[model samples]
Target: MKGLLPPPGAVRLLSIGGLVRTTGFGIMTSISVLYFTRSVGLSAAQVGIGLTIAGGCGIAASVISGRVADAVGARNTAITLVLIQSLAVCGYAFVTSFTGFVIAVSVVLSCHSAAEAARGALVAGLIPAEGRVRARAYLHSVTNAGLSIGAVSGGVALQADTQGVYVGLILACGALFASSGLLYMLLPQVEPVAAPSGRGSWEVWRDRPFLLFAGLNAILAANDTVLVVVLPIWIAQQTEAPLAVFSVVLIFNTLMVVLFQVRASKTTSDIPGGARAMRRSGVLFAVCFALWAFASGQPAWLAVVALLAGAVVHTLGELLWGAGAWTLAYEMAPDHAQGQYQGVFTMSTQLETMVMPVAGTMLILPAGSLGWLLFALLLLVAGLAAPAVARRHTNRHTNRQGTPSWN
Candidate 1:
């Protein structure tokens, strides 16, 4: 509720650019795999393996890109990454072989991940600390709206189910990425800041507390797999509920995010507040999974109701978790190295996206409802650990003045 209005000039411009980029992102996500396999004639296994490798490359690129942003300037780095993303996407049209497909996708994903790291630096440079997280949350809300539009547009192409339509959509995405890059050109520029004293360009890697925090956030991020990868299967195979429940829940989650992301982001006002939000979110996630587990044996109508209830809880948890993540990732870092710090956080998330589809399915699909419960417990444990870890590691960190902080 805090940031319900459209953001001011900089945030609004950034959101518009972000919207353009995410729409392209949405389009690619919707059709890229299908295009690789169905249109380009690569096998599903090949597409999967290629994408996995691409994701790994993207993760590695984030740290380097963050360093680049700190050296050259974030706006310049972000714009360059977006431009690179456009070219690589266009190259997809030339992919007649699996190798070409891998090469093209790797470039696109790498640029995307790198651009996020650079963009984080850009935002940190442009937006003041007081308004930063809320601005990012607003941009995130806009991003969901753009992605939804793109996904719906991609679905129109999917209905055609022709190679020409798929290729055309990919080309369209390339154009959008180019446009987004131009929009980034419009944002006000800031000079790159130096890394903190006693810190290397790669300080993020050596900051054990930050890594532990990032890892915790990654564990919490597994909630995404619950919705995107596992939930549809659970609806069809585990419950008597119609597959329609999946759509209902997905739509519900999206709507909640668009409406409440800023309100959720308000949790990041301080370290303790963010940690409490994380702890609370874990419980909500656990409750949502438990609700889903209970849905399996229910009659169709009851199962639908239970599933929707679960979605509500999950969405609430997601809001808190995302807000806390933004706050903590930013607050814990020194201002000078925010880009590299953001790069570390982005890499953790990219790592999750690469691994969770297979890993989460392994944990849940094998044992069915029981597996879901076990997954819920894992989330709860992560949530419970939040405050303890924050209290311990954060205490060890000193402010710029050099005395202990987080008191």
Candidate 2:
């Protein structure tokens, strides 16, 4: 049993590291806009524009960092990025002007995106092929737990509403991010795989199949927007369910992921298995959305019932989606360029996230039931396409010689 799991010490360090890092992350995620608008005197429009610019930089940095990870070492690149990110986050405290805010946040977002890609590569190097996805699942649970705690703490700061408290919290978040970098230093380092070919430059961009896979992942990744951005608004304005339903549903979803994410990931051990899990998740998503769609304009009790059912289904779908995405991202990537591959994967989701604020609000918000139905169909199509894409990649890559050892 001991042999089957990651070393206990390694797992313990990783767990503590994830918990601490995301606790800060959770704080910022909930209150950064409030700090900008209230304390810093930046307009909501200014903040949005700044985020738009920063998101673009984040998208670019995702791949840039990955390439850097391959060029240097993943751990080295991760440490450098997070350290720079700490400084950028600290700069947020002084962002009285929109330009200052944009510059600080741009650097912070770039570092965040890059560090994630680098860390992905680092994890690949640290964990065995068979256990990477499971390890990722456990980390997800830990990070979410941290986020829960951070969100609560951020709520306290919000209640305080003083500039000094906000600034103090922001500084503390920067420190936590820096602490995460120190944790990276503590972990045993993974050796950089030597690049043997001249084609090492942006090799992931040239792979057409991976590009398609990445595109599909972007669609699947919308599961995130659906949870955080879209669901609350829809429940508030479109559905007859009480607004409180969203809060409950969110808590339910979080708890389910914290408890069952690793268990669900057990099915997603390999590429074919992951693709299948993704396909199933798509069906579940479609069903969940359908429930929500029909909940629109229903009686309050009926809508509440539908929303709770939808939450249960949505969480299940999310669990499967997380596992599948992790496995596909890890296994399809060649050993030497895990960072590049992960960057591209992360970029897809980042690009989606960057656009989703305006797109989800403008397109999905006003459309009501029809919008939900249409989004459901899009997910269904992506889900159906996943297995086909995975099968094609497998056929193209697998040779008569046997399964490629790199996977």
Candidate 3:
């Protein structure tokens, strides 16, 4: 394997761009509900509907953007999307009705989603394979840091007025768009890889290991949604703690990402075994869920302690799964079809987004215990199965080459 480090310049540019974009996203998301309800005078149901529509449109846009990246080049595609996204943010200021607000938000969400796919593909295109995972980790770390700051600042901005919120978002969008342009200039222009003979999206299914990875990723992604959506609801319903305590937990989670993600990346870099890392992450996540379950039984103070412990475990799993997953995606992809493969991989997260609402509802229903239990069981199964699948896949590859191997 090549040395497990990205070019210093590439790392710097990608991390900076990631931070700026995440900050913008965080700022906007932090106030979206309030803005829609108060500023646009939308009912709660209308806001939910708008969010649903926006999410569906965003997924479709992400899929299309991957193809656009392949056609026009990742850097150019990203630049175009960011520009549109910036305009969309500014357009929010003009929204005076429910319909207009939905349209503006949908446009912005779609552009942001598309830009994210382009950025992921761009990073994969630029960084060396051995270091891609760590590079992505660095990006994630910077993104989390930016999000923490933006979320806080967004709340402060909202205290001013509707106009102030719109102005703040507009500036946030402008900064992100400008950062995208600068990053584009810094990234070395490289020709897209030639398409493989007779290659198509269907060909990706031929790789069993990659398919398995995607399935496992979808499950993990569902868990991620639970963390963001369900956990807070559960906390509020079960404890006397203020909602601000949930914010404190999130801050701790983000702080860990900012401080420890890179270190975790380096630690996982030399493993040469994505399945092993994934298994470890799975175990940690199981423990995290167990801690969360225990939290329900504790007093408020102990509940906070449980929440913090669970957050640490969950964050560790996040670091491990992230570094491992991207590395596996990069390694399994054929040289000529990286963009297509990356697009398919990116779709797994989209699928997760779609599944989250359903899963969250199921988990909090009358059979909540059973729901959490089932979720935990699924994670354990995926974790246990991954290493075996990896070993089998490796052995099969070796056998095809007529070589004995210890996978």
Q: If scored against the real structure, what TM-score would every candidate get?
A: 0.95, 0.95, 0.89
Clashes of each: 0, 0, 0
Which ten-residue region of model 2 has the weakest summed lDDT? 398-407
Query: Model 3 Cα displacement at 52 (Å)?
Result: 1.3
Candidates in descending lDDT order: 1, 2, 3
Candidate 3 has its poorest 10 consecutive residues by lDDT at 398-407
Assess the local accuracy of residue 177 in candidate 2 as a C-alpha lDDT between 0 and 100. Answer: 89
Candidate 3 local lDDT, 1-407, one digit each (tens) = 12322346987787777777778777887877887677767899998888888888887787678777776688777778888887788787778888897899899889888877787778777887777777888887787877877788788888876756666676666677666666677788745777767766445668777788778877766667878887888777765456677777777777777777766766554324676677777887787877776677578888888877888888888877777667666766666556556766777767778777776766543345455666777777776676666665655555334342224
- Report the error of model 3 at residue 393, Å: 4.8
Residues 251-327, model 1: lDDT tens digits: 88988899999888875787777788888999999999999999998999999999999999999999999888787
Q: Spell out the clash pairs found in candidate 2.
A: none
Looking at candidate 3, what is the lDDT of residue 379? 79
lDDT of 3: 0.73
- How does candidate 1 score on lDDT? 0.86
